[model samples]
Target: MIIPILYTFYLSFFDWNLIAPTKEFVGLKNYIEVFTDPVNQKVILNTLIYIIFLVILNFVIPYFISLIVKFFISKMQGTYKVLFFIPSLFSLVVGAMIFTWILNPVSGPLAYILKAIGLTMPNWSNSGILAITVICLITNWKVFGYNFILLLTGLGSIPKNIIDAARIDGIPKWRLVWNVILPMNRGIAIYVLILTIVQGLQYVFTPINVITTGGPYYGSSNVIYQTYLNAFVLYKTGTSSALAITTFLIFLILLFLEIKFVESRDKDYV
Candidate 1:
């Protein structure tokens, strides 16, 4: 893995073509070209946008949703837990397909409501930016239930006695959660943050492939999509390899930041 990764990084320094049967060692030229190219610039910006939405949807929204689920589940029992987890069982393909049908302008229930209300429902899959945002939304909806399960486990790890003591001390609900519950579950918080970032990046490929295919003027095409287009569509091996290396580096940097954040939070836990 390291060899291939390193080789790609090395290849990024060259202007090589697979068809020409010639390899040109153009150090930093490819990297410079990638930065200067308008299409490449758009791809990079779109990728960063995707990452921002992915982190917020996959981490922040799910975290809050899980908290809500756990809070409600405290008074409920087994059946509710199973019901809440139903979405977790759904595959991404299935979820995306379901949402696509539901978003259909002519026949979907949502569209019908919008039409009744004298409003327009845009064709999300056809619009590049809209498609990308919808992809993130679907990803959030699909994975939220599983995130809830993870958070439920974290919530369960907290000792009930401490919470009861806080309640008895006349602490407000938010204060109890912030001061008592969150501090105790710092490990869980960090674990969730790291896992969410990793998972969000990993799954970004699915929506781009399934829904947009980097269409509607490359609006939804992220770095992964651009790499795929270069390697598979255009058969530009060197360029794709360069893109892969840059993407890996960017991913590593993001991962490192998350690791540092986790480490900083861990100090409180200790």
Candidate 2:
């Protein structure tokens, strides 16, 4: 890991190509180009968008859903868990392909249902925002259950004595959840948040690749996909290395902040 990362960092300072034998030392030129390139700027923006939506849909929504499923539907919780988690068993390519069929505006079942209801289906694959939204939805559908199960495990780890004590103190149900359960699960919550922040962009890459290929004028192109395009598609090894290093630095800072601010607070709660 260290060797490859160091090598990539070294390569980022030079003009290199995978196919070409010759290499040129550019000394920050690749990094400069990455920052100034218009498409890369858009790719960064799309990455931020992907991270925001992925965290919200995959982590936050699943956390709340798990809470509800664990508390309200305690009897059928096993069935619900199985149903929600089934999608996570599929590979990313398969999941993306499934959603691509579902979102097909012309011949998909979604279009058929809309037509039956006398409504027009929008072209999901060609529209930028809609395409990203579809990617988020599909990605969430595939992974939300996994997160849900993690949160459920977190909930289970909370001691029954703590909950019983809270109830005996006459805490209302909602207040009990807000004050006791949520606090007790802070460790797992922070874990989920940090994991999402770190891996969110990578998770969205597959659907974008399979469904839209960052289409609608590169609207959904994220940092990871852009790096892939740069290295493999465009054969700009140095530029790709620079982009990867930049992304790694950004996420490293984020992870530090999470550990410093969020995890520190979790310690207090725990």
Candidate 3:
């Protein structure tokens, strides 16, 4: 990892196509191009959108569902967990192909069901927002189970004595969860948040590649997809390296902010 990262950084300062015999040092040129390129701006925007969708669908929804299963439906929790986790066991390529067929506007069961209800399905593969939405939903569906399992473990780790004390103190169930459980699960919550942010683009990559290939336009493209296009498709190694470095820096900053924020909040809670 260190070697490749150093190599990529070294490449970012040069003009080198994959076929070139020798690299030409073009210091800052690749970085400048990456910043000035309009397509890169679109890629960044799409990545941000992907992160937002991932937080909502993958993190928030699954966390709440896990809480419900842990507390409200304890008797069937094991069964529900197994069912939810089944999707995550499928390989990403297989999952993407499965969803592609399921959401096919022509012959997919989803389209057929909608048509039976006198409604039309949108062009999920060709349209911009729709394409991104479909990919995000598939990603969420595949990963939600894993996240739920993590959160369930977090919830389980809380001491039953504390919960009993809260109950004896006449705290409502929701209040106990909000006031005691959530704060106690801060470590796992932060872990999940970081995972979502760092792997957000990667989670959707396979689906986008299989289902849209960055789409009717560049609608579904994220920074990772753009990097792949630059290095492999276009053979622009320097630009791809620059893009990768830029993305890494962005995530580094985000990770720093998240850690600082969570630490401060944890201190306050203490």
Candidate 4:
């Protein structure tokens, strides 16, 4: 892992096609190009959009659902767990293909159902927002189950005595969850949150590659997709390396802020 990263950083300063015999020294030009290009900028924006949507689907929604299952639902809890987790067992490529067929605007089962109900299926591939949403959905379908189970475990691990005490004290359920359970589960929450942001990007790559290929004028492309395009398809090795390095730096910064945020929250709880 470290070797590839170190090599990528070294390669970022040299101009080379993937097949080139020798790389030409380019200094910082590749990095400058990655930052200055309009397409790359749009890809960055798309990446941020992906993260926001992914966090909502893979983190926020699962967090709430886990709470509901852990505290509210009494019947069929095991059944619900199995149902929620079934999707996680599918590979991303298979999941992407499955959704592609299910969501095909023309002849997909969804389109047929919508048409039977006197509605037309919107061609999601035609719109940037929809395209990104479709990709996120594929990723979410595969990721949400695992996240839900993890959060459920975290919630379940909260000491029953504390919960019983809260109830005996006539504390509202919401207050108990907000003021006590959430803080107590911070470590698990932090891990899940970080995993969502990082793995979300990686997970979407398959769907984007299989379905959209960053279509609608590269509207659905992300940092990882752009790097793959540059290195493999476009054969701009240096630019791809530079983009990878810059993306690593961006993620490093985000991770740092995340830790600081988690630490601050911990201090507040103390």
Candidate 5:
């Protein structure tokens, strides 16, 4: 696996078609072209915006949801956890397909409900930012339950003694969470951040391919979609490899920053 990835980096620098008689070295042309190409620029910007949205949805929203679920979980048996977590068990493809139907312009449940209320809903995959935002919304909804479960497990690790100490110290509920629970769970936060960011990059692809297919004028396509389109649709293997390599580099940098942040925070925790 590592060798293949390393080879991708080497191949990305060249203009080598898979069927060509001679592989030609193009230096940094592919990388340079990535930045200069209008479509590639749009994909990169769209991907960055998607990442920002997902980080908030995956890490921040899930943490609060877990806090809410924790309150209920303490009073009940494990039944509530099971019920809330059922969605996480379904395949991403299945979940995206289901949501696509719900968001369909004509026959979707949401559209039907809006019509009944004397409202007209625009097509979800409409031109411009609306398409990308809809894709982000669907991605967030599908991954939210699983993230909540992760945070719930982290919450469960908090000691009863600590909660009692905070209570005895006259700490307010919000203050207790802010000053105690959040700091104590910082490691979990960093872990979730890294995992979510990495997975978030790849997870948007299913929805983009299925719901939009880069439709409504390529509004929702990300780097991964571009790579797929290049390789399979356009048969531009060299350019596809370039896009793939760029995706890998972007994620690698993100992973590195996350590791550095996590290690620094761990020292502070120590």
Candidate 6:
């Protein structure tokens, strides 16, 4: 793990094709190019957009849905769990392909249904926002369910005594959940939050590969996907390495913040 990452970092300062016997050192030029390249800039922006969408669809939505299912739903919670989780059982490839067929602006069922109402489906593939949204939708189908289950487990893990005491004191359901449940659930909540950001930004890789190939001009690509494009498709090893290292540092910072936040919260959590 460490070796490849270190090698990639070392390789970032040089220009090398994977096949080349000679590495030409061009210290920090690749990193400079990555920052200045219009495509890389867009890809980075797209990744940030992906994070925002994923946080909403996969993180915030699932957290609340888990809360609702766990607390409010009084019956057949098992069935709901199974229904939500079934999508996660399939691979992203399957989900992407399924959505591809379902959402195809031409000749897709959605298009056909819209046509029946004298309406036309917008060409999502031609637009950046819609393309990314489609990718997010495909990813959300799989991720939302998994996050829901994980969060549901966290909510379940809350000490029953705390909940019981809150209830005995005639705490309103909303107040009990807001004042008591949310704080204790933070441990798992933050884990899911970070996982959501990680998966939220990265999980669209398969859908993007299949649906857009990061097109209408890299409209749907994230950092991970862009790195793969540079390394394998473009065969620019140095640039890819720079991208890899840049992404690593960014995520490393996120991991550090998560640890610090959790540690401080644990101390303050009672």
| Model 6 TM-score on a 0 to 1 scale | 0.94
TM-score of each: 0.85, 0.91, 0.91, 0.92, 0.90, 0.94
User: Which is better, 4 or 6, measured by TM-score?
Assistant: 6
Clashing pairs in 6: none
Could you tell me which residue pairs clash in candidate 5? none
Model 4 reaches what TM-score against the true structure?
0.92
Question: Pick by lDDT: which candidate is best?
Answer: 4
**Residue 78 CA displacement from its true place in model 2, Å:** 2.2
- Which residue pairs does candidate 4 place in steric collision? none
Top candidate (TM-score): 6
lDDT against the true structure, per candidate, is 0.75, 0.86, 0.87, 0.91, 0.79, 0.88
**Model 4 misses residue 56 by how many Å?**
0.4
Candidate 2's error at 167, in angstroms?
1.4
The residue ranges of model 1 lying beyond 4 angstroms of the native Cα positions read 77-81, 257-270
What TM-score should be assigned to candidate 1?
A: 0.85
For model 3, residues 1-270, the per-residue Cα lDDT tens digits are 899999999999988889979999999999998878888888888888898988998899989988888877877778888999999888888888888888888899999999999999887777878888888888887888888889999899889999999999999999998999998888778878778777767878888888788876798999898898899988999999999999889888878877786777667768
Backbone steric clashes in candidate 1, count: 0
What's the lDDT for residue 60 in model 3? 95
Off by over 4 Å in 4: 254-270
Residue runs of model 2 more than 4 Å from their true location after superposition: 254-270
Q: Between candidates 3 and 4, which one is better according to lDDT?
A: 4
TM-score, structure 5 vs. true = 0.90
- Superposed by TM-score, candidate 6 places the C-alpha of residue 198 at a distance from the truth, in angstroms, of 1.4
User: Which scores greater on lDDT, model 4 or model 6?
Assistant: 4
RMSD of each: 2.8, 2.3, 2.6, 2.6, 2.4, 1.9
Per-residue alpha-carbon lDDT of candidate 1 for residues 120-222, written as tens digits (9 for 90 to 100): 8998878767888888887777666666667778888788888888889999888887778777776667677666656765566776777777877888888
Worst 10-residue lDDT window for candidate 2 reads 261-270
Off by over 4 Å in 3: 254-270
